[model samples]
Target: MYRYTEFDKSFVKSRAAQFRDQLERWQDGRLSEDAFRPLRLQNGWYVQRHAPMLRVAVPYGELSSAQLRVLARIARDYDDPDPDVYRVASAAQGKLGTERLPTHCAHFTTRTNVQFNWIPLEKSADVMDLLATVDMHGIQTSGNCIRNISCDERAGVAPDEVADPRPFAEIMRQWTTLHPEFAFLPRKFKIAITGASEDRAATAWHDVGLQLVRNETGELGFRVSAGGGMGRTPVIATLMREFLPWQHIMNYIEAIVRVYNRYGRRDNKYKARIKILVKAEGQRYIDDVDEEFRQIVEHDGAPHLITPAELERVRASFVPPALHASHASHASVDEAEANANGHPLFARWLQRNVAQHKDPALRIVTLSFKRLLQSPGDATADQLDIVADLADRFSAGEARVTHTQNVVLPWVRASELLALWQAAREAGFASANVQLLTDMIACPGGDFCALANARSLPVAQAITERYQDLDELDDIGEIDLHISGCINSCGHHHSGHIGVLGVDKDGREWYQITLGGSDGSATSGAPQPGKVIGPSFSAAEVPDAIEAILTTYRDAREHDERFIDTVRRVGLTPFKTSANAVRVNEEVSA
Candidate 1:
């Protein structure tokens, strides 16, 4: 984990204080809501459907135990909505045929940020104060500025990693934070970086995707792609640069964003993403960027070109933490395997929730937040504290938020696997279904988000309840089932094997199912959007339709084939036929 220097600490505290003053003026009627909206958004505060939501940037998904504890404290102390506000929100949600919304909880977003949906605007300053104490804030988390830079959760520890991307991600964070040049662009821009061979970070689906690669001379550089995004129109980014020297990444990205800032659309927010511009301009856009780069270097002297010394300064902060000396005396690999074999539940957890690490003695263990009744990616105040404690005890005082909306103890020792599993199981976070169907990704839908056309929680809950059997889930195998309440794609539904998108139809909630989406992982192949099977189904029929599709795959899949592979090989016809049958049956029953 990157430690915040005194300068970084002071910068965050000053920003928080500045936001406090802005909030005070807004509260006293000196500033209009229209005027204060941008001010609040720049600080990571948003007036959502029923409450003021706060999104705290967890840069590159890294979190210290102390930071996690502060987050837990915020959830416990400041996330409660006013009684009247809760009552009205609950009533409105009930009318939509969904359960009352949960408060005093933090949701781990697909972008690896932390969100609180029910915090009051009055306490915003105090919350900011608390976040600053931990060197965390909502800066650039909600505005149309450069949002938080995300990276592979396993960046430093993955076995196949070529280089640790955190150093570069940190450098980008420093360069982009409050960048006056790119702030308030045509739309919110996202960037993802991964150093691993497997595309664990889903870089291809980002506004700017960067893969750390080596050129012919084995010199470190970046494979840059731009324009990928998901919304009303999903697009895979076009390859802009095959190999850009690592030192010039900041300079290159500046040219890319600068071109977009100058030429990207602004009139319609719907069509303002860089993906739209890239799609419309195609090769012309690349040519423009190349020309811009040339001008920036030759004319502007490439001021942002990173120096080797500056790179080393940032990289120094990411030095791997020393493992406990006791690890040398811990149980051997054979003994750990024997222990896992003895406990079937532990064995299952080790297989599903744990991943290989660069160090054989260390394992990356996922603490599953997806469980019965609880919303996926949501952690209660108590659960957050438990995770903090677990991280301190098992993972060298650090944990990471994964892109799939789960928590990862990246430094967990192999010997502590059983103990950590026991503690997590006691805390309702040891489901051992990391990428299973039950482990779905969902956003705060109409129940909480004002932009949602339908509720995603109900559909997620329904599917979770339907697939509660661990044996059945394991048998079904790894499947990405992502649900989004709207076309915004907050839940990354466009990349799921079975994607469910909520839609509005005649003032009622409906769902559109898609098949064969991938996030460009080693397992999921290339990054691409799923295809809709047919017309939308009522929210009530979504679960049954999903079941029908999964059943189709199980019946026809070849031996040991994953759901995605099976979908690819057999095509969407069988799944589509079964899902459509469910829709017809529901209509007839109704």
Candidate 2:
């Protein structure tokens, strides 16, 4: 993990002092909510339904054990101590308690490069102190700003990767942290880089996705995808540069950001995402802008001087941990455990969720979020603490967060699988359903998100509940059911084997389904919306619709066929008919 240098520490301290002063002004009524909104947002604070929520960016989902311990402390000190009490408590009480004290909901997510929580407005100073100690700070995490630049957590270590993208990611982070050049963009922009053969970073969903690849000539390069985003208008991004050499990647990205910053729509906030810009200007126009920017950088001979020495300096900061030669051979224990435990569930999880490591004997264990009957990508504060502890115990002194919103203990031994599973079960993190149908991704919809047109979580919950039976879920095999509140596709509905998008029709919520979309290494595309299914169902009917679709697929699928392959071969008409059939059957039964 990259420790903050003296310069980095100084920068954060300065920003914290600035924010503290801003808070004081707001307290004295010298600054109105309107005046403070942008300032607070820049620090990743949002006033949510229950209380103020702070989203701390954890750059590329990599965090030291010490940083995670601080997060646990934040959860225990600021958020509710009891998970049950916290979940059901009244908003007024929660807010009152949080307001009276410096409480916050400590959350670790795959987005951004920092961890954030909802702390009391008054405690900004204290929070700043805690951040300073860690040499971490919230500088450009929010606002209509260039948010944290994300890169693959396994950037330097992945054997199949072209090069460590962390150096590039770090350079971009430093350059864009608070750069005045493109600060006041039309809307928030996101940038991500991946050094893995697999699209673990989901670069396709970012405003700018860079895939680090080696060209045919064995020269380091990048495959750039531009205008890709998740928002009201979802576009899976188109390839802008087939092969941009490593040296020119940053320049090209600067050019794209500049183009969007200057011409992207500002009047309608809904249309401000880069996806819309790509659509309005066309790919050719965006390409021209990128070319023009590249020309300027090349002509000036500015970006060219970032030599091997500078690259080495940045690389040294992100080098992989030193492992001992003695830390080898957990395969025997893993095999023995599997033999004793007749549960194929555990075996399947081990096979799919674990990754091979650089060390011959060690393995990278992924704590998969795809679990039967669990809300995809959601973990309570308690669960967060538990995972943090496990990371310390098993995965050296650091952990990795996946773009899929799951945690990865990237240095666990294979022998510790059973023990780790036991601990996870105690913490409610064990649900042996990685990649199954029940591990659906869903947005926080009307229940929490103000941007939602319909409630997405409840619908997702309904589907999970319907398929709650572990045996049934296992039988169904791997299927992705992703739902988004609106076209923004925040939940990545467009990339699921079964995609459910929520929309408003005549002031009532309705769902549009799509099939065969995927966000895997081989396939990178958005799922096209299928036939409209009429007015959205009540919370109870949501499950019924999903069940019908699944049943239809189950009946029609060939042996060993996955949901996506089945959908592609048979089309959505049968699923549509089945959904209507289920609706009619339920009405008659009722």
- Output the number of the TM-score-best candidate: 1
Per-candidate TM vs. native? 0.98, 0.88
> For model 2, what is the error of residue 239's alpha carbon versus the real structure, in angstroms, after optimal superposition?
1.4
Candidate 2 structure quality by residue, lDDT tens digits, 1-590: 67788888887888888888999999999999999988988877776543555666676667777776666666666654333333554242221222222133343344634333345667766676676677666666777778877777566656677777888887777777777866788888888899888776778877888888888889888899877775556577778888887777667777787788878888999888878878777966566776777676877665633567877887887765665233656665567366537867666666656666665556677676554444456555556667778988877777877666667787766666767767776776667666677666776554445566676766776676567677787788888777888776767777777778877776667677766677654333342333344444545666777788888888999997877778888877888787777667768889
Q: How many steric overlaps does candidate 1 have?
A: 0
Question: Which 10-residue span in candidate 1 carries the lowest summed lDDT?
Answer: 324-333
lDDT of 2: 0.69
Whole-model lDDT values for every prediction: 0.90, 0.69
Measured over all alpha carbons after superposition, the RMSD of each candidate to the real structure, in angstroms, is 1.5, 4.2
Candidate 1 to truth, TM: 0.98
